[model samples]
Target: MVEIKVKRHEPALIVPENPTKNETLELSDIDDQQGVRVQGAVIMSFKRRSNSIKGEDDPAKVIKEALAKTLHYYYPFAGRVRETGHHRKLVVDCNGEGVLFIEADANVTLNDIQTQIIPPCPLLDDLLFDVPGSTGIIDCPLLLFQVTRLTCGGHILAIRFNHTMCDMLGFMQFLYAMVELSRGAHKPSVMPVWQREVLCARDPPKVTYTHHEYEKGGDKSHEVMNKDESNIIVPGGFLFGPEEIKAIRNHLPSHLQHSYSTFELLCACVWKCRVKALQPDPEDTVQVSMTVSVRENNIILLPSGYYGNSFVSPAITTKAKNLMMSENSLLYALKLVKQSRNRANEEYVRSMMDLMVMEGRPKYKDHLSWMATNLTRKGLEFVDFGWGKPVYSGVPRGTSLVSTFTRFKNGKGQDVIAVVLCLPNEVLLRFQNELGKFVGDFSPLISPTSKL
Candidate 1:
């Protein structure tokens, strides 16, 4: 068992430089995120050094300053969420109450922690700023930050965001803006667009396409959380190099081999491998849901800087027997995944919004359901705060609902894509075996990118 010793809890509420006196910002319908409410954290590791200009270097101080400056533009994050219209509407009270910031010390070094590979849950959780017990999801602060100083002259910077506030892209856009401010840039390169009203449902709310991905009729009371831990879900990171990616692509049919991208192919492989590892009943059904950026597919074109939850939940479902019995299961799954991707067009996105407006946010649950999202090209690796770029940057396993795929360098500086998978312990072993067969002798546990 790993222990995280907390030195102190300092709630630093940095108000925006230019505050909005009294205003409430209504979130887009997409912000009504379906699924469980848990604080999601993104952890970034930076090494400490002395600065001649400042005499002493402190990441917390620099980050706080940068955050304050950046929050002036992205002030909605520095506010609190409040309910109106008898809990029908969720809005951000832009009172500039400020975000929660904490300062802590850890006894471990950068090397002591499992960052590049599968990180420890306790250590990762320790990096997250604690949410007050009295605070629930509906009324909690939208943003929180924590700066943890390691014993080896390295520090960990972790930020937690309410999923309802923004998607991964929006969250990173804000963080990147802060990095620019920290680098002495007066303004962000890209100014955020807060025209969430554009996403509001139309007067009539036309639903042209059928949204089969979401259930239509269901009793909300029957939707209870799955508390069973008999088949404990374990998250691990699996690396796939260029060769492995090429091999998976080669497995595709020559007739339409060039139609698929690396992400689609890898999604197919992981989906099939995970299903096979689970050893579900022959007649059981499985579903693989991947998040698609709605900004690219929305009927009303969103600005480049539109930072909100603009994503369509696209899922492909099939029978376990069909997948297990197929000679080329990966290819079969690839075809299905591609089909789902193709369907996430303008019509589908508009239809999804209409579906939510009509059906009232549906909750999907099933043991065979798996979710995946790609953040490989989100510029997370480019986050710099004067000390240097982060050796490791991304979210840890807080929920098994979604597995985020990102590319990071290895010890040898070789580029490898990491698939963060949270599965049963026994299934994890089998899943690694399947992944190894594809990526020639792939190590179940590999060293992270930074040895510097």
Candidate 2:
């Protein structure tokens, strides 16, 4: 456990190179949901390059210039988000102020990273460098990023963004755009579009389907609502390669084998494992909330380049007792997870939008909830900057209570999915033991092959 050191420089605002429109943009309901209102971050580790410009000159200056040019086309990101109207609806104030950018140097290399590139990385505060008072939703930069040049010549990009502006896929669009500019592209291949109005509530507002994710909580214990901070919470990333995933899949009954997707199966596994780790009351009902995108294989059809939040989390609830039932418990949880996930159709999204407008944009804040988002195919790991595609790219760590599944290469060079979870330190051992039974060597082994 050698101490990691980072030398940082002054932070500055990077506005678009060419002044764009100074008008405001209204956000969609999916964008400003209370659950996602907080800051979201991603940490990328780029390996050292020999023939690239990013490898020759100062990586910070090169990326800084690229960021400014990239912001020109996607200028909304250079704006700040503020609450407006009676509902506290959020709108982007395109004032051309700029996004926050910082440059730093690290004394570590990419090979030094310890696994699956999950959250809870050491020296996170040093890597991301959150400037004072720069995190507020209103009158604050919509995005902030720090690029740390490592001793081995590689660079790491740690970025924090206002989630209300876009979802994971939308965020990657901006990253890829920046990458293109870093590599000398005049403009992004896919033009950035700003049509948040399309995903807003219907003309009169109508709740056609039930949106259970936002509904009030079920029967929860006292600790569930008012959590005790006495226990230390640890964020851990669990890798599930083809072999590990197959091990869990083999447990399903023959008839139900094909019924579950990889994301649903892993979520159910983690949901049950977490329940066991926490030792919740048997009568207490728990919920696993998963974010489903409405863009692909759904009813919503926005323009190809629209980069905003267009996803919803649909929660599945079941009693703790059922999850403790023998090997069949995984099967039961799998079914519930798959069923809840299928609700991401167009009607559900529209109904959710209407519900938000009709109910004044409510936040349920369910006590017994866990967020399981699928980042296995968000197209982040594939984008190449001047150096090359990142060894690991995705989120940094737990969002207090979140599980992100991302594409990863295990120690054996096998492509896999890493399911990252955050839990109380006391129960981490128990949680690991429970999951360890599924497959041998399930722990993440990339050696910071990444951290978000």
Best by TM-score: 2
lDDT of 1 by residue, 309-384 (tens): 8877677778898777657647788888877777777777767666666766666544677777888877776688
User: Each prediction's TM-score against the native?
Assistant: 0.88, 0.92
Worst 10 residues of 1 by lDDT: 219-228
Model 2, span 1-452: residue lDDT tens = 44568788888999999989999889898887676787888888887776755445777887899899989999999988889875779998898999999999877776665442354465578789989999887788989989998877888888999989988889888988888888888899999998988899998999997565665434344355347843576676666677778878777778887777888888888888777877778898777777888885556888988899888877777787788666455878877887778767778888888888888776644555677889888887786776677777767676445678787554566777766666667677788777776655645332344432
What is the lDDT for 139 in model 2? 80
Question: C-alpha displacement of 34 in model 2, angstroms?
Answer: 1.2
Candidate 1, pairs of clashing residues:
none
Candidate 2 off by > 4 Å? 52-55, 114-117, 215-225, 254-259, 440-452
Local accuracy by lDDT, each model: 0.71, 0.77
Candidate 2 residue 293 Cα shift, in angstroms, is 0.7
Residue 387 displacement in candidate 2 (angstroms): 1.2
**What local lDDT does model 1 show for residue 127?**
79
Please report, as a residue range, the 10-residue window in candidate 2 with the lowest summed lDDT: 443-452
